[model samples]
Target: DRVRIFSRRLTDVTDSIPEMVDYAKTKVKASEFLIEGEVIALGEGGKPVPFQDLMRRFRRVHGVEDMVEKIPLRLYLFDVLQCDGKTLIDLPYTERWEILASLAPTESLAPRIMTRDPKVVNDFMQAALKEGHEGLMAKSLTSDYAPGARGKKWFKIKPSDRLDVVIVAADWGSGRRVGWLSNYHLAVRDDTTGEYLVVGKTFKGLTDAEFDMITKRLQELKIRESKWTVHVKPEIVVEVAHNEIQKSPRYKSGFALRFARIAKFRDDKTPEEADTIQRLRKLYEKQFENKGRLLKEVP
Candidate 1:
C-alpha cells in the first residue's frame, strides 16, 4: 500500500516495484514503512564509482533505465524503524535485529548486514582504512534509532596519523582572526641540510583559547613582514593529519599536503625534533602501497 515513495539515488521504478510490493506484502499488514539505503554506483570493473560520478546518475529521471544500465548500484542498508501496524521505536536493538534478520532477503536483492561487535567492527574499520576510506563509525547496540539526532550513541573514528612540523610564517587573519596573525605556513626540517622545507598551510582545528594564545605568542615572535606571509621565529610546533599527499610546485620540498588539519600543538617538541620532509614522503609512499593491496582483497 505504498501510496508514494521517494529516493534520491534509485531510478528504476519497474525493478523497484516487485521488491517494494513484496516487502509491503510480507512486512506490512496495515501501516506503511519507510526504508533508506545508500545506492552507490559501480565502476567498470565492479568497483565503487567516486561520489561525483554517483551524483550524475542521481540527476537523470527521464533516462533512468539507461542510467541504471550504465551505472549500476550497491545498496547498503543499516536500520529499520516501522513494520506492520506496530512501531519498533520502543523495542531494544536486539529485538529489532532479530526481526530484521528474519525478514531480510538473502539473495542478490538484500542489503549487506551491519553489526556492532567490536572485533568485527574493528576488522571492517581496518579494512576500510587500508582501502582508503575516510574513517569508521561505531554505534551502540542498546541505543534506539533516533532520526536526525547527533547523540553519543554513535561515534566516528578517524585515523589519527599526524606529522609534527614547524611553523615558519603566519598570514594575517580576517573576520574572526582580524588584526592578529592566525593562519600558518608549516614546514618540515631537512635533516641533511638543516633547513626547513615549506610543506603546507592550515588555519583549522584551533579553539578560541588556542587562537587567542597563538595570536599573542606570534605577535611577540614576529621578526619581519613580507607581502603575503609574515616571517616568524621557528619556535612553534604543530601536528597535522591529512587524507593523502600530492606533489606540488608551490612548496620547495616538491610535495604539498592535502586535506591537512591540526591535531594539536606540540609544546614539548622543539623545531629541531620536528619530522623531516624525507620522512613525510616515505610515509605517504608506504600508505599508497598498502592501499593497493586492500582493494584487491575487498571482492
Candidate 2:
C-alpha cells in the first residue's frame, strides 16, 4: 500500500507522493512490495548528475514541487524484496530479478546486459563512464539477495583513489568541541612489519554527531593518554581523501597524506584489513614522482 526506499533502514523520505515519488509508486505494479535501487538526478544528455546537484533537492523540507521540476529524480531499481504479502528473502537473485521485471515496467529497471565476455564487460563499463555513472555492479545470478549485508556475490566496481587508514589517536578538541575527540590521527598498516604506522592527522569532514560518537568510542578503546591527546587501540578504520602523497620522516611509515580529510569511518573493515603503507608508497611513485621531476625541469 506504501512505497518505500531502503538504504541501511527504511527512509522517512516517503510522505505525500511528490512528482517523482508518485512516478516511482506508479511504476510498481504490486500492491505491497519493496524495491532496492539508487536514486539519481538526471542531468543534460540524460547523464546521471553529480551528488552536489542532487543534494540541493534532497535537503528540501517544504515546498518541493518547484525543486522537483528543477531537478527530476529517477530511481534505478535493481531488486525486489517483497511482493503482495510474501517476503522474497530466500529466493535466488536471478529468480527475484525475473519477478521484479515481470511486475515493474521497463522505466523502473536498471540498465543491464547479460554476457560473460571480457570485451563486452569492458565496453559496458566504458559506456557507463561516458554517461557519468560511478561504475557498474556485477552480481552473481545464483546468490540470494541479502539486505544491508555486503557479500562476495555482488561487486561494485568503481574508481579508487581514496586510502583506508585506522585511527591511532585523537586530540581532545577546543572551543565548540572542547570535550570531544576532534582531531583523528590516521595510520596505515604495515603488512610486513605487522604494525600500524601513523601517516597523518585530520579534524576535517566530520559532523558534530560524528565527533561526539567517535569521542565516546575512542574513550572506550583508550590505551594511553597525554595532556591533550588520547591514544587508542588501532580499532577504528577511516577512509581518507587526500590531494596526493609525499615522503616524510615525521612518522615510521616514511610517507604522509597531503591535504587529508576524513571521507568516512570504515565500519565495514577491520584494522587488519585496512590498506597497507606499501600502497601509499606505490601511489606516491605513480602520481607524484614524474610530476615532481617535471616541475624541477620547468625552472
Candidate 3:
C-alpha cells in the first residue's frame, strides 16, 4: 500500500515527515486510506511543542531522523476520507468518526466528546486550554466532511489578544484592493535600539475607506519602493489582534503573530508607544508556562 501526506497548500509533504509515513505503514490498520490528520510536535510529558518546532520538521530536507528524535511528532486523525478502498467523505461526521476510530488506535485519534450542553462545552474548552492547547473545534455531527472550507457546521474556539504595532512596509494589493497598498508588514519597536523589527504581515480586517486612507498615508510615508513592496517609515500605529505569538526565524526579532489582523487604528499612540520586542518575548514565554518545552531553544 502507498500513502502520502499533504500540507494545507496541498503540496506533497510525504517526504518531509518520514516518521508519519513510517507510522502509517507499520502502525495503521487500514491497507488503503486517505486520512485527515494533524501532526503535532510532542514534548516532555506528551505535551505539544511550539509551532516552530513542527514547522522546522516540515522544512527539513535532510537529517530528518535527528530532527524527529529531537522533536517527536504525534498524529491525531480527525477524519477518514477513505479506508479499505471505501470512500467516507459523504458520510456524516458521526459515522465517519466512528469508522475512523475503528481504523486507528485511540491514542492516534484526536480527543473528542459529544455534548449539547453549553456548560459542558465551556468546561471542555477550559480542559483543553489547561492542557496547553489553543482551543477546541466544534463540528456538527450531521455534516459531511468538506475539504478546504470552513462553514457554519464547523467552528474553532480560541482566545485572541491585541497589541499596538507599527507598519514598516506594505505590499501592493491585487484583485479588489488593486491600486491600494495593502498586506501590511507588522513590527514591534525595539526600545533599547529605537528600531522596529518585523514580526508578521496581514491584510485582514480593513474597510474600503480605511484601505484608501491607509494607502494614501503609506504612500506619503514611503521611504523606498520595490517591485512588489513599499518600504515606509514606521510612524503609523495600529492595534492588531492575534490568536497566538510564535517563535520565528524568518524575522529579525525572532517572533511572529499567528492569525493576525488589524483591529483598529491607534492614532493616539506613536511608534515609541507601540509594543516592544521585549514585551513580545515576555508574552511568548508566558504562553508555555503550563506546557512542557520540547527544546530549550529552537534547533
Q: Give Cα-based local distance difference scores for all models.
A: 0.67, 0.77, 0.89
List TM-scores for all candidates, in order. 0.56, 0.56, 0.91
Off by over 4 Å in 1: 1-113, 137-156, 293-299
Instruction: Show model 3 residue runs off by greater than 4 Å.
Output: 296-298
Task: Sort the candidates on lDDT, descending order.
Answer: 3, 2, 1
Worst 10 residues of 1 by lDDT: 290-299
- Model 3: weakest 10-residue lDDT segment is 290-299
Candidate 3 TM-score to native: 0.91
lDDT of 3: 0.89
Q: Please, what are the lDDT tens digits per residue for candidate 3 over residues 119-222?
A: 99999988988787788889999999888896899999987889999999999999999998989999999989998999999999999999999999999999
The alpha-carbon lDDT assigned to residue 208 of candidate 3 equals 92
Count of clashes, each model? 0, 0, 0
Q: Name the better of 1 and 3 by TM-score.
A: 3
